[model samples]
Target: MSWVTLNDMRTWLVAGALAFALIALFAPRIDLTRDAYDVLAVIDITTSMNTRDEASGAETVSRLRAAKTALREMLAKLPCGSHLGLGFFTERRTFLLFDPIEVCENFAAIDEAIAQLDWRMAWEGDSYVSRGLYSAIEVAKSLDADLIFITDGHELPPLPFSGLPPFDGKPGDVGGLIVGIGSRTPTPLLKYDEEGREIGTYAAQEVPQENRSGAPPPDASTRPGYHPKWAPFGNAVVDNSEHMAVVREAYLKQLASVTGLSYAYFGQREDLLEPLVAAAHARPLKVASDIRALPGSLALILLVFLYGLGAVAAGRALIRSSLNLPPPKGAK
Candidate 1:
């Protein structure tokens, strides 16, 4: 889309204010909405998570393991009166690990689900970020607590999941924090064969097999360790910090878009969950006053969106000037 000039922007803003004033004069002040302490941890379980770190000799931990550790730790640290939940994506779709629970609450069911994690899902891997997110949003709506996204932060395109309600999750009453774990830079690992031998990872074309090996078996569903033919190889890896930040930013932005929640970046479990719990306790119940009104959230979102459009216009103009742009020419 083209950028709006300062003059045009000012005019648009004025027009908007006038239009809103006319509506507000006859209509009413737009009302906002929110909910109680709901938190959902959306984790990534894509196949690439099996790589070790170059910096720390964290050979015992892969990305998924690190995430699981953080998740369990966060669960144990959750304060009373707050909700804790887990959502994760593998093969491009999300599964509800531990649906939102509260401290001092019975977690047996959620714990059972957590224990059910294994090599392959009830179905094979498909890994889509958007699908995971949409599922998480649905689960979050069923909850009345602040939603927390515990993730590696990468979003894939939507992989259609069944039994999901119809809505993109905007104009909903869910809010919470996004705690990012692991680096954004990818940590691609060497593939292993079935015998856990370090066979090379899968390439576009199949490499050579053994000497007339008795008809080598079919391709694997899991990571290859010792594919009789391809030898193991490793690539120089970059730090994942940047990708981590980007994935989280994307996830949190999606969270805000779906549910108007302020995404906080806290480090440790205590650092993360405590602030959310505190915010929940102190959460202004002013939104309760708005529920009785008609289409409040929609109206307010429109107003906020209008402000965003103005800011975007100003930003584009600045960018154009930096690149040496002429005044936008048009007949007066």
Candidate 2:
């Protein structure tokens, strides 16, 4: 009501603001339950992934490299409490390099591991993509983590006319996404030496032109040179575009359908994030949440309001002095 009382109240308000700010500065995070993800991602390191179908600035990059880049970006976007594991798919199997670990804590190690994935890691030259996807699902199941399988979807020793082998496991048991990596346009599949030196592109005859996994064509018995014992499929060079690598989107989609997984293409930097997050099932996790900022911001706003009030009071005092008005009752 009086100037003295108003001044005292203002001083108390300033002190209260400072106290709240100090508390905010020293406040510790509280434990809270929140939803987080646990993902085990397997990358296809087969030879077909060496195809340079993605562009980076003025340079073209291999599908594997582009996948790694997208993964690194995704790693940064994952929530702090979420977990991520890495693995390499080759030789009809997915080999788990490490179990799922907290993403934020082991970010550097996870990033370095992804960067080091190479086609030479394959022990065998065969790329059975369907089998590899199944293996990845098993690995994820063992760890109780969601699966993220990144591949160009190029199957070596092509699928037989009978189609992919039956998946024994129940579909949708382990949920996640199958990320297709590569362009639709066919590109020459690059060949490399054991030492990891790029030699040249594979010729059509160099790769399997037709499915060899099942019994030879039904008409094999009637063929001219068909030998049931030795050349059941007939030793003929089939002219097909098998050597050219492309993203088998349709095949990958079929695989996704059979496995109860979602499908996404790795094109732009942000392409993988949305599908990945959508595929992830939220698991409750205890997280240490820092709430100090809330009170700190409130304190800051209060201080600003107090400053405005002081400025108005000073302006009033100045105006009154210039007008030569007498001091108000109980004024200091």
lDDT by residue (tens digit), candidate 1, 183-267: 5444433365655565755442232212222333243223245354462211223232322213345655554455555555433
Instruction: Summing lDDT over every window of 10 consecutive residues in candidate 1, give the lowest-scoring window.
Output: 204-213
RMSD of 1: 20.7
Tens digits of per-residue lDDT, candidate 2, 46-139, equal 9999899898778898999998888888888888889999999998899999999999999999999999988777899899999999999999
Candidate 1 displacement at residue 279 in angstroms: 7.2
Q: What's each prediction's TM-score? A: 0.46, 0.85
Which runs of model 1 end up more than 4 angstroms from their true locations? Answer: 1-36, 54-60, 105-119, 155-167, 189-271, 274-332
Model 2 gets an lDDT of: 0.89
Worst 10 residues of 2 by lDDT: 265-274
Relative to the unseen true structure, what is the C-alpha lDDT of residue 286 in candidate 2, on a scale of 0 to 100?
91
